[model samples]
Target: MIRDLEDEILGCTRCSRLIDYIRKVAIEKKPKYRNYQYWGKPLPGFGDPNAWLLIVGLAPAAHGGNRTGRVFTGDMSGERVYRALYEIGLSSSPKSESRYDLVELKGVYLTNAVKCAPPKNKPNKEEIGSCSYFLKKEIESLPKLKVILTLGRIAFDTTTNILGIDGKFSHMAIYSTNRLTVVASYHPSQQNFVSGRLTWGNWISIFYKIKTLYTSHNA
Candidate 1:
């Protein structure tokens, strides 16, 4: 299943023009960056085949997921996320370095709204719209997806739009739509880290809510 998804993504030129432009700029700006080599390749999705929990993150970090082709890998955001997953009994391993390390997810699947790395880590609306098809397909492919943990406003908005939900952002009001529990949280970007906006305890609190919500949904 994963192999097929990768093949489809690699052959996809639906957004080729935009991808090409982004690649050109990334390469020209950071020639030494390894992400430039695989910048054009389709990003990979990870986790259980029947995952009930789906994590929607922003586009892959230029040097992190974009370079490794695995969501949340080789990045600080991933480090904190995986640690929490491990603590919450959602991951088999604490380390999410790469697929080669046998890192596996349990009952949770991870993906991004935009598969490709956007310039400056921000994907414009046009680019997000262009990649919506893939996101739609992924959501459809998962037969047991019941919860979505959106890691920022962009991710929250995009995932909600894809799921056909209509509402404004409310961190306090955890809503249920399309048979999914939508949990919103701030993106664990470097900016959040340096500014001390998302501390370790606060991050864990979000995941704790996810655990409780998911458990309630299943019950």
Candidate 2:
């Protein structure tokens, strides 16, 4: 059933603009990846089905996830995230270069607000609304989800809107309810990392907090 949902997401063409852009980029190919075949489709969330930690990212990077077909794969942001997860024993490997890289997530599921890679890494309000259905479906499928760790303000706001919650977004903010918890963190994008806004220590601190919450909750 999960795989079926993934297929559906991959085949989606709700956003015509995004579809055309992805296809064009895939056909042209980046100079460095000319020999590589691009996935060029909407990406689906990947991880343990019964995950306790649900990570929501803003969107797939144009040349990263769009080329690799896996959310957060083949990107610097992905490297940072996967490395942090591995250090904390949440993933089998510290890198996610491709879908077949054998990097396995333990208790965490990673997804995006918009499955398709958007132009300029920014999705319009309408595009985000169009993709909300998939996000909702993905969340519903995670039966054991306990913590929603949103990377960046866009992800945090989108997720909160979906959950019908109101909270301020900050690098280490945590908003808990009777049912689940929502944690906010700065995205590990090149802009953030290069600008020194989201350092390695800052990135790991978010996961450490999530790990603590997950362990205590499951215990």
Candidate 3:
């Protein structure tokens, strides 16, 4: 099933123009984006198959997941996020290198809204909307998705909207509607790290809430 999904994603041309633009920028303007690799390849999902928890992020980081081909791997954002997951016992392994690395997510599945790496780490609204079908299909494939942890406001809003939920954003608030429990948190971006907005303790708190929600729902 996952393989089929990946194939479909690879063959997708919904936003071909946007992808072309990204590829051009990555290849032609390589000198400008020193932090990221401009390999111009599609992104892939990582994590457990029968995962009950789904994590949604904005898009692949240029030097991070985009280069590594696995979601949230080889990036600063991933480092902090994965570490928090490990500390909270959500992740099976502490380190997340490649998909075949010594990393495991027992009941967690990770994916991004956009599969391709966008320019300057920002995907336009049209591109995001075009990629919504894949996200919807990914959610549909997860039969045990009881909790969804959205890493940022954009991911939170996009995932919830895709799930057909209506509500405003409130930090640390759990939204439920028989389908799944939605939890929101600030994205573990460089800005958050530099400004000390998302500290280790704060990230752990968010993960604890997700674990608690999952436990309570299953109980």
The CA lDDT of each predicted structure is: 0.77, 0.88, 0.78
1-219 per-residue lDDT for model 2 (tens digits): 556678899889999999998998899989999999998888898998878889999998888999998888989998898999899998999889898788889988999999989999989999999898888788788888899999999899888888888888998898877768999999999999999998898789888888888877778
For model 1, what is the C-alpha lDDT against the true structure?
0.77
1-219: candidate 3 lDDT, tens digit per residue: 665787788777677765685466566644545665554566757777788888889888765665566888877888887888788887876778765587877888888888887877778898888888888888888888899888887788788889888867666767887878988888988899789987878888888878888889988
Best by lDDT: 2
TM-score (all chains, Cα) for each model:
0.88, 0.96, 0.89
Q: How far does residue 107 in candidate 1 sit from its true spot (Å)?
A: 0.4
Steric clash count of candidate 1: 0
lDDT measured at residue 28 in model 2 versus the true structure, 0 to 100: 92
Best-to-worst order by TM-score is 2, 3, 1
Residue lDDT tens for model 1, 85-172: 9999988878787646778888888988888777677788888897877777777788888888888888888888987788566553
